[model samples]
Target: MRIGRTLPPAAAPLSVQEVLSGVAALFAGKRAVERFEAELRQHYAVPHAFLLSSGQAALAVILTALKRDRPGRDEVLIPAYTCYSVPAAVVRAGLRVRPCDIDPRTLDFDWERLEEALQGGRVLCAVATHLFGVPADVGRLKAAAARYGVAVVEDAAQAMGGEVNGSKVGTLGDVALFSLGRGKGLCTVSGGIILAGSGPVGSAIENIVATLPREGWGDALKALCYALALVVLVRPSLFWLPRALPFLGLGETVFNPGFALKRLGAFQAGLARGWREKLLRLREARLRHATFLERAGVAAAVPLHGAVPDLVRFPVLVGDPAQRARLIEMSAEQGLGVAAVYPEAVTRIPELQGALAGGAAPQAEQVARRIVSLPVHPLVTQRDLERIAALFRAEQGEQKGR
Candidate 1:
C-alpha cells in the first residue's frame, strides 16, 4: 500500500491530446518508439538514446556490446544487493555475472572490493546500480573504472529519476538504461530505454528488438488490463475490486512482463488525450506527493534528471535483519507488501561463485540483510506514510528492547 496521495491511473484528456499527434500504435509503430527515444535523449542530454522493449533488454544489449568490446573476456561486476534481473541481464548478454559487495551506508558498490574484483577478474565492464533511487558515488567508481579501463553499464532500472550530485544518472556511464515497464515510475505499460553513447549502440539494440517476439491476443488483453490498473493503482481505494473477485480467478490487476500494446490505427485519439491532458497532471500529483514525503523527513530527495520519477521507491535502512523480517511479517498482516529486491548476497549467487567464493563482504552483507524498500511514489497516502513511519519507529524500539 502507498504512503501518500497517488496519481490518477492515466493522464487527463487534454494532456494526452497534446502529445498524441504522432502517437504510434503500441508495438508496430517504430515512429513512436523513435519519438520516445528522442524524448529520452533530450531528457537525459545524451548523445544517443535507444528505447528497448525492456530494461533488462537494455542491460543485456549493453552487456552484449561490452562483450563485443572484449571477446572471451566475459565478466561484469554487479553489486550483490540488486535485482536478480541485474545478473540475469549479464547472463542474457552471454557474459559471466561476477557479483561484488556494496557499501551499506551508500547503497552502492564497495569501491575497494570492486577494485579487487576488477583487477583480479580483469573484467572490462561493470554494472552500477543506484539501489533505491540513490545514485552510487560515481566519482569514486568512475575514477577507479577509468584507471582499470573498465566500461560501466549502469543498471538504472530502479534508478529512473535518480542522480549523482547534479549529474543525471543515465549519462554517467557508457550506456544508461531505464525501465518504463510495469512497476516503474513511468508506467509505459511495457518498454525500456537504453541511452546510447553512439549510433552503433542504438542500432545494435534495434537489431535485437527485431528478433524479439510481438504481442498476441493474450498479451493485448493483458495490456488493456494494465492500462486499467494504472488508473486503479493510482487510486487503489477507488478501483480495488472486492477481495472476493480472487475466487473467480479474475485477478483485479494484470502485470504481464511480455505484453506490448502495439501502435494501432485506433487508440490514436486516446493517446493524444492521454499524452497532453493526462500525463502532465499525473506527473504533477506524483511530484507533489514526493515533495510531501521529503518535507515529512521520510527520505532524502535527489535532483532527478531523465524521466523524473513520478513516484520512487525508497530503500530505507533498518540495520537488523531479524527486525526487518519481523516488520515484513507484521506489514504483510496489515496488507502492506514488501520486497528485498535482489542478490541473496553477491557472496552467495552461483555466478559470482568464483570471485571470493569463500569471502565475506561486510558492507554488502549488512546491506543485504538490513535494507527494506518502502513505497515513495504517488500511490502512497498520508495515512500510509504515518503508519509506515510509526511502524519503523516501533520496530526499532522492539529491536532495541531485544
Candidate 2:
C-alpha cells in the first residue's frame, strides 16, 4: 500500500565494503588519487587524466586552460538548457557565456542556431552535453565546431560510461569532464576527472593542475559529510526528508557560482577507485529502464539519435506545465522519486540573465517547463518500474478522458 519508498534521483549505492574502504583510505592518502587517475585513463583510453575536486572544478580547469591559450577568443558557447554550473564555470574561467538554444527533441544543441552562434565569431569553445544519459551527436557537434575553429568540450559529467558508435562519450570531444558526485555514475562522495586530447589543451591542463593547490582539510571534511549523507539518505524512503526541507533546497535549481576550485582528496579517490566497474553495471540497468519507458510511450528527455547513453537519470517531457506538475507531485506522493531535472533554462535563471547570447530560447524554455526525470538508478526495482509505468499510463488515460 505504501508506494512512496524513497528512490534516489541518482546514486552510488553504499555497502559495508565501501564504508570500510573509505575508512582505510583516510590513511592511504594521495596514492588513491593517483590510482584512480590511472584506472580512469585506461578505461577511457585517454592519454591524460587528472582527478579533481568536483565536476565543476574539472570544467573550470579546462576552460581556464583553454582561455589562457586564446586570450582574444573570450566566449564559450553552451547549450541554453543545461546545468547552471556550465555557465558558472565559463564565468569562473573569466570568459563570456554565449547560450545556444537546444532542440526539444534531442536536448542537444539546435544545430542551425549553434552554427549561427559559431559563425558569429569570438567563440573559443563549445560544450556538448550528453544530458540525462542520452548521448548527443558529439561527432556532428565537433564537425560543426571545427568549421568555426572552436574547440569542443564534452560534458560527460552525467554520462560517464556512455558510448556513441563504439567510442566513449568522454573521448569524443577535444576535452571531456566527468563528475563523481553524490548522484553521478561514480561517486567518491564528490570528485571529478578531466580527460583531454594529448595536444596543446592536454599540456595546458597538466600545467594548470600541477600549479593547483591540493585539497585542504576542509574539502576532506566535506567529502566525509557527502559520504555519510549518501549512506543515510540515498534510499527512496529517506530522500523525502531532504526534499521536505525548504532551506536545504534539495531539488531547487540556482545559478550561484561560488564553488571552491580544489584538487581531489585522497579519501574521495580511494572511495571511487573500486566503483568504476559497478558504474558500468549500473549503466546497463539504466539502459534497460530507458528502453522500456520509450517503448511504453514515455518520451525521452533527449532523443537517442543512435547514440548509447549511460544515463544518470531517465528524463521525459510530460507535456504542458500543469500536467508535468501533476505527474511530479503524484509520483512523489507515491514515493516514486519522480522530479524536475532543472527548474528553468540557463537564460531564464535570474542570476545568469547577463550571460545569454541576446535571443529568445523558445525550445529551452518549453523543455524546461515540461521536463521531469525519473529514477533509473541501480536501486530501482522491477516493481518500481511497473509502478512508474502504471502512473504514466494512468496519466495518459486521464488526458484522453479530458
Candidate 3:
C-alpha cells in the first residue's frame, strides 16, 4: 500500500466548521431541517422540497407516490447502466425495474430503446439520470413520458449543482432527487433532497414524508461521528489508511435494497450550513480538473451538450477491460484515484435477475466493462492530473507496442 498521499476516487470533504455546525444542530431541533428545505426550494424554484435519510429513500418515496397516482402502471424505466442504488430503490418501492439500453458515448438512454420502452404501456415512471454529472436530455424524455401519462424522476444524485440551458438540473423532471451523501457535490455526510411541484403528486409525497420517522439522537450522534471522521480522513494524505482496510469497503459498489427510510437528520442538515457557497466552489474546482483531463485526451469522455456538469468524477472509456484493470491497479499503487464506477450493468446484477424486465443491453454491458472515472473533486491537485495523464499515455504506448 502507498504510504504517501492516496487520493480517494471521489470526495467532497467536510470542513471543521461543518462538523461543529452539525454538533450544534443536534440541539437546534426541526428548525435546521426546515431551514435547509426552504433553501432547497428557493434555489431550485420548486414549491415542494423534502429531505430524506438517503437518496434511495427519497426515490422510493417518490416512486410510491407516483405509483399511487397510477396504480395500474407498476414498472419504472431506468438506464441499464446506472447506479445500482436506482434499481434497488425501484424494488424497494415495490415497483418492477425495466432497464432501457444506454448510449455508451453519452451514458444516457439509447433513444430508440427508451421510446420502445415508453410505448410498452406498463411504465409508471422513468428515471432520467445525470450520470457522473453529465446531463441526460430530460426535455426529450419528459416529452416521451408525457405521451403515456408517465412521470419522470430526475436522478440528480450525482449532479446536485449541474446546469442545462442555464437551468438547474434538479428542476428538469416531474420530481427530482439529489443526494447529499459523501463524495457527492455537496456533502452532508449523508442525506437526500427531493423537489416536486405543488400538485397531487407533491401532496402524496408530503404525506409519505410526514409518515416517516425522523433520525433520533442515536442516529444523529452516528452521523456526527462519520462527518468528523470524513473531515480528517478524506484527504489524500490520510485516505490510504482507510482504503487499506478491507472492512471499510472504501469504493465498493453495493446493491443491497435494505436501507433506512427516515427524514434527514437535523445534524446532517446542519452539516450543510453553507451549502450554496460550498457547492459552487466544489463545482468550479471539479470543472477545472475535468477540463484538464478532457484536454489531455487520455481517453474518450462521456459527451456533453448544452450542459455544464458539476462533475464529481470525470469519466472516460477504456475499450479493453484488461487495460482498464491495469490502469486502475496502477492508479492505486501511485495514489492517483482512478476508479471503475460499477462492475456491471443493472441487467446483469445477480440479485435483480428475476426482478428486472428488459431485453439485452449490449451497449450498457460494454460501458460497464470499459468505463473508469478519474478524480475531479476539489482535493485533486494539478500534479495529480498530470500524473494521471502520464499513466494513461504510458498505457496507450504499451497497447500500441502489443
Question: What are the lDDT scores of the predictions, listed in order?
Answer: 0.57, 0.82, 0.90
**Model 2 compared with the native: what TM-score?**
0.95
Candidate 3's displacement at residue 296, Å, is 1.9
Q: Write model 3 residue lDDT over 1-402, tens digit each, in one string.
A: 778899998899998988889888878989999999999889888999999999999999999999998889989999999999999999999989999999987899899998899986899999999988988999999998899888899999999988888899899999999999988878898888899999999999999999999999999889988988899999999999998899999888999889889999899989989989988899999988887877776554665432336788888898589989999999988999999998999989999988888788999999999999999998999999999999999998889999
Alpha-carbon RMSD of each model: 6.1, 2.0, 1.2
The window of 10 residues in a row where model 3 has the poorest summed lDDT is 299-308
Badly placed stretches (over 4 Å) of model 2 are 1-4, 303-308
**Per-model TM-score versus the true fold:** 0.75, 0.95, 0.98
Could you give candidate 2's per-residue lDDT for residues 7-88 as a string of tens digits?
7677767765676676677687878778888887888888999988789899999999998877788889989999888888
Error of 1 at 319 (Å): 3.7
Decide which is better by TM-score, 1 or 3: 3
Tell me, by TM-score, which candidate is best.
3
Candidates sorted by TM-score, best first: 3, 2, 1
